[model samples]
Target: MIPARTTARTTRTRRGAVVAALLALGLGLSACASDTDTGETETGDESAAASEDETEVSIGIPSGWDEGIAVSHLWTAILEDEGYTVDSQTADVGVIYTGLAGGDFDVTFDVWLPYTHASYLEEYGEEVTDLGHWYDDAKLTIAVNEDSPAQSLEDLAGMADEYGNKLVGIEAGAGLTQITQDEVIPTYGLEGMDYSISSTPAMLAELKGATDAGENVAVTLWRPHWAYDEFPIRDLEDPEGALGDAEEIHVWGTSDFEERYPTLTKLIGAFELDDEQLFSLENMMFNSDEYADEQAAVDAWLEENPTFVDDLKEAAGV
Candidate 1:
């Protein structure tokens, strides 16, 4: 289970590519959404445009991050309608940022800042341009099903055996996973509990199963996530400040991105989605089976929000 996309649909020339992205296990080039939008997770390495047309844009996002996945495709839909060809890539935060610096990627919508993606920006900040901070309130969390005996990370040490001594996590490289392993576990005396790193989808499936059986389960997660809305879970209190504070997720690109994409940059800079709007998009794209395609899900989401696309466009003066 690949988690929730950031699945990189690589190299299409439609000016509005919504190509099928291959999951983390493969590199054959495809479409997926990444979080770098509260955006943080993803897989694959394909980036850049397939055409010489300046209107063609290449987007990248971190693999397995829902916020990234949702917004990447949302932008794909809008750009497509506006007659701009879009090529989107999904990969790890490291890979995406690397590519962005190398000019392999044009822009990425999910760049969590001041915490989750701090290492990335520290290394690549100068090479990339900040389009804008689209959404604030993105956060990383250690969540348990609402009925669990443990209400906080500290409480887990005593009941580790009751929950099978395991804390399920998303992709190994995910920002959430890293924070859990490096910060949360040690700070909370949770080394006794087994921390497992699997794909986001795997963690989600486990979440579903645990919820279905009414079992106690813990997993890595974040705000602006579809899980909080769809799952019967609550974040464990990070009383010791292991998980860090709320963050602003930004839109990022190559250093020259703003120069080349002024109008689009303005539109992107104007972009922002609150919890309800973002959750709706993620749930539609990742949680629902209603639409068989990424673009279709985005279209449905836009229909409900009604004025989101136009509002961003208008705000950007595009």
Candidate 2:
């Protein structure tokens, strides 16, 4: 009887041990399944978030230049087509450079280089990388109404006595304005004349009024600008070269930003517009009746010029 009882206890102990081992194995398998499911769900969510984050960038431009705004919007729309959302802001050129240096702005397409923005470039050129020239042979020029007797910039120098001893200029801080103050006026020996540095819109308004009334009006002008098309004006010859030689409009961004956003960078680097294309775009923005909004004008241009868009994309390797 004692031997049988001992054998029975041993058997019961063995059964309990086996049951515990099997229960532990089942729990281990369930934990692994739970971990695998959690990992897969997390990865899927992360991927979706990353994809959503890639569709946008921000740009900066100068204030009140409707033409610049339209061009910027065109580029933004092009980027949108390539899976990017774009935001733009308008400020002074100085502010734009500051913002870009701080990484607040991703790009600027309106930098007139080697002259207009020489100081800015000297200060920040090393910090930023030049993409390429967008428009060429751009410069500050003096223009007069087609009917005016003042045939050239030199003609205006003697007529200052009749014209209130004033040379009408654009915004006070503009590169053209500075050139007029530092070089143009001095070179022309018009030191005693009063200079009127007005805002861009104001200057345009003055020109329109003067031209419509058939009076002599001279103001700063540049190529590829809408003012040239809207008004029948001629660029006054620059004998003294105070306005400097012809320059190119450049595209620029913060250093290494292209590497950070390779696709956007390449697209920006590939951007280039000839005189005709830019002039057309500017004219549409400033003179078109089809659209009142600058951005709408840009959209229309893009719709009409799809081939150019493809070329830009191809150049960008997009």
Candidate 3:
């Protein structure tokens, strides 16, 4: 079982704890330059020369998700190449939607739709434009050690009795953790199963400890995440399918954005990454120490996949 944090520490320790937790799970951030001054004057000039370049566009993303930052940096780099300035901030999902609805932020590329963030879309559906999916077949999942007898969520049904009636989860309020508490436990008749929905690092620490001891443990897991690459784990089968089928990551832009920056909007709309591409990018940015530099990673990917970059540019009608 994972140790619980006091109420005070819970609030104050989230951000730092999350980063540390990710590192323990083998997801290390690259040693890239701070997002503050990229010093890409030449590319910034080109972005300005592009048709419909905005003076500046602010993008909001959920706090603690490094992948989002990496994606934003890549987009910013590309936009700079085309002459548009990008300003990115880390805010909660609520602020992101509110900012997008009120035109505080021009766009957000981290909307996990049809499941998580459904309520936000319901509220601001009309104020934002849907800009297609970037990543496909991504979903919240439950993963277990490969050697564990629990092959699926079904195997986890009787786990509470065997493993101290405790199920480890990520931070509270996270969509995946909430769903597991509200649905998975009840549907699976795990009424006695007590959930420990702590920060990602706490959960991972417990997971590591359990796996090392060959003890039964189940935790919230997701794709495009570094855990799969770092650990020997298998996704538990979702017999009830509470997790839903493969969902796409959608992009959203403020209503005025399209009219004000058609070229930039088009580029955002055209941005798409297949699983392999995204995995490669994520690995470079989060998994490997040498390749953590965001710009360097983007530059290498652009060199290797010139055709894909050209296609995105052409789709933007550049």
Candidate 4:
């Protein structure tokens, strides 16, 4: 009882200590708020980058067609430049169409319509969408060496043995081969000639060898092909139209393709490649020793046609 009393000086000191502690606690709370705000800003930045990364595209390309390869790579380059991740798959044309219908692929570049790929469109047209035609004047042709006497497929029957009794053709699954088997051969009386079914490069090799050796050669070819310019070959006149009418090379995609990529759909729809442009681009990619490095080939092409990228971007409204 005797020592329980506190002095005024002691009371003042305790009040001062309590005020100092409150000030320290307030400073700590302010520092915590600042840290939380900085952390939120950093998290938002990371989220934005991840969102950009999530935008992607998957393209299916027909294995034997150089045109498909060319445009697929070109699109991949363009999309990558715009910060999209792109995947390119090489498969047979039939497989590509099926994949598109099943949603396994996002898009494809080389769909020949009205004649070529007619059957594919019939089978999958309901599930897929035709983005647009990029090139017209596409057709199947039977070509001969420039000096050959055969001016048309009608003349090939009698002169079959003169050209080694054989007609060199591309892939067996190709629409061209189908047309030749079902229509062209019977219409032109070409059954007497032995038909050879092989890959495009193999057929091209045969054509080049025969032409280089000064021998007569007959080949199944198509327009917008580089062989016409690279080798001296002339397409036979198709008076009967058995090889089918002129086609439009189109871009095809899944049903939801436009909804998923409105900008890209516009860009692809606006794309145009005439005979000269397609031939040169294909020649650079397919006929060069440097083609194993496809990106390099595409880059070389873009360098040669410098305005193409700007034109595509402008068309896409990017």
Candidate 5:
């Protein structure tokens, strides 16, 4: 068996590489201040101010994931209402996990367990904290237009030319994309199909464009996503199980997150959203053309749900 120290050393090395890549991608150290090098002392008048400011939580939102964006904004709005400041930054998945492990980010709401993001968790699980899952039955999927001729992932290989021989995808660094490249392609013999890896927004834009014009389009997507409610899409049957099984969605944070904000942690831990609620919330945020802003969209949903925030706080005993 490998020694624990060696495994830790290997993780650290991989994490360092992730940090370096993030920096090169222009994801600089601007999201959150490092705990050890903040250059501030906890004493005197400054101490009181620091103590008050310590209630602030830094959250990292992985780009292109609508669920994370929605929940992160929701937390920020509600936390601010509760007199706690919230900072939300958009970053790639690699950068987000790295920041959480290094204490550069206080929390993030979009960790997919046992499958998507498994590699990142393996690397940084020791330094970061798992705050428990908020949503279960989360899934990774390869979706196509509902009217498409191909009904399953297996059918794509034979009729590759019918769908323009392309599979639109999200961020190249995303775990879903990694799985698609490593497992889906090989398992389904889809190496002949051209896979386009771009941002989530780009993939959505392509989907919308194709669907609008009655063109067949295939893209990587996930459940609890607004696209299902907003677009005419259906999940292709995965007989090979190349896409993996359904997993839970977790909220992860810095190691001392619980100790630093016990009440908030409790509230977050008790937080849970069923499929109807989650899908409706995302639909408001993504489907509505009027509420262009994330916060505005969340506010719209809260207005519709009416008692959701207050009810959640009461349930958490906070």
Candidate 6:
């Protein structure tokens, strides 16, 4: 077997190359800060933020995507606190990307790259500025309960009957659902089973029911999800490369956004979040019943992560 360290090293190298190419196209880091010797950019962003422009900002959040919604709200609170009017709306990824390309939406924080959203970016990349990616290790997977009969998609394809002869899915318009319908099912010859296109909530309900009853069920899922912590489920290995590789979650803005909101652009460019921080924020915003209002959820999250805004401000030099 290949050494695990070598495999990890190879994966990271590939990820770095993809990130570099994306930066070359337009990560817009030059608009924010200078590159350091370590290839990481110093994020103070004083190069542009002399005065914060007080303008109305429109942000798009992808429907059924918790991460997008969380970040959209998080940024909304931050930007509004910085004295800007912010409008946040929810829609599908396709609609958001199309609107962004046409200069209708000002910013969106959940564009997945080099894999899940390659088509959208290919069509709209030139029309938009990639503020930068905040999170890496985002991936799509077909998950099953811990006690399921199959350990991988290859195993499931042949034993469809064991998983109720079906595969549960999320929102019909979601990227994960589309990719599973178009690429995954075909690649694995899973056309024999019933593939149900439903909403994320519906899929979660099904998952909860199945797992609680000790039944077998497979559903489309993604990493950095709160469900993994709540449910006793695991991702099925994809040996045929049907599902794409790990993706970086990026923030996208209209091509002229930098000119329109220089300071905001710089601040957005300096954003970064690891899995733990993101998962915690998302859990607070989504899973917690105590904070129904998105802004309130953000406030509660800030209470827990007291230095979040302060650290980001310091990094952005605002």
Best by lDDT: 5
Report lDDT (CA) for all predictions: 0.77, 0.67, 0.66, 0.75, 0.78, 0.77
**CA lDDT of 318 in candidate 3?**
44
Clash list (residue pairs), candidate 6: none
lDDT tens readout by residue for model 6, 1-318: 211110010001112333343344433323454466665436543533534353778887787787887888777766655446676667777778887888777999998888888888788889999999998899999999988789889898899999999899988667788789889998888999999998887899999999999999999999878889889999999998788889899999999888888878768878988888888888887678887566777767765665666677568766
Model 4: residues >4 Å from true position, as ranges? 1-54, 290-292
Candidate 2, poorest ten consecutive residues by summed lDDT: 2-11
Backbone clash pairs in model 1 (N, Cα, C under 3 Å; residues 3+ apart or in different chains), count: 36
Candidate 1, residues 160-202, lDDT tens digits: the string is 9878899999887677777888898889888888899988889
TM-score of each: 0.83, 0.80, 0.76, 0.81, 0.82, 0.82
Say which candidate scores most in TM-score.
1
- Which of the two candidates, 2 or 3, achieves a greater TM-score against the reference? 2
Q: Name the runs in model 6 displaced over 4 angstroms.
A: 1-54
Worst 10 residues of 5 by lDDT: 4-13
C-alpha RMSD by candidate, in order? 11.1, 22.4, 10.5, 21.7, 12.1, 12.7
Q: For residue 235, give model 2's deviation from the true position in Å.
A: 1.2
Better of 2 and 5 by lDDT: 5
Q: After superposition, how far is residue 76 of candidate 6 from its true place, in Å?
A: 1.2
- TM-score of candidate 3 against the unseen true structure: 0.76
What is the clash tally of candidate 4?
0
